[model samples]
Target: MDTSQHSMHNLFEQLGLPSSEHDVEQFIRTHRLFSQDIRLDKATFWTESQAEFLREAFEEDSDWCEVVDELDSRLRS
Candidate 1:
């Protein structure tokens, strides 16, 4: 079982993004989800693989879900 701590920084790394705190904040700030109807995984800015990872993370309710949900919340703001 994977025991590594899951956080926004780690989640960004999992998504193959820059995992720094500032980078995550900048990404969320610039990429607000304009429509409530659009899911995080369906956002156009993500590459296909990133989208798939997000989709699966939520669908499986895996360890990554909380962090992913956090990201979703931030983007929605």
Candidate 2:
């Protein structure tokens, strides 16, 4: 097996986060959302869509929970 095939996904698994298409993409999005209403410790530049996504994720705070829960459920299955 290619050990690095899903390195990003695996890292996310370690953090209990789902793999994003690109870390930079998520990085950019997360801070942009943060910038909308708050000055973040880490600054970023992302499009409005990115900001929307990060805002949604922050509001729901469920993507990671679901990913972890899904992994557990899969293990059970």
Candidate 3:
């Protein structure tokens, strides 16, 4: 049983990205999803492993889902 809470910072860390608030904001600002049709895991900026993690998180509705979804939304906007 895994019972850990995750935030955007944590999600970035898991994805091997910079985990600071400023870094996350900078990433989101630069990586805006140009098309609504593009899935978060399919975004070109993500490395294969990062994409897989996001895919699995959403597919499993795991503990990481909320923050992953939040990141998805942020990148789109």
Q: Where is model 2 more than 4 Å wrong at Cα?
A: 1-44, 64-77
- Cα shift from native, residue 68, model 1 (Å): 0.3
Candidate 1 lDDT over residue span 6-63, tens digit each: 9999999989999898999999998999799999999999999999999999999999
TM-score of model 2 (CA atoms)? 0.30
List the candidate 3 regions with Cα displacement exceeding 4 Å.
none
Better of 1 and 2 by TM-score: 1
Over 29-70, each residue of candidate 2 has an lDDT whose tens digit, in order, gives 543332234422122443455444445544575344344333
What lDDT does the true structure give each of the candidates? 0.93, 0.41, 0.91
Winner by lDDT: 1
- Residue 44 accuracy (lDDT) in model 3: 86
Error of 3 at 3 (Å): 1.1
- Which pairs of residues collide in candidate 2? none
Better of 1 and 3 by lDDT: 1
TM-score, each model? Answer: 0.95, 0.30, 0.95
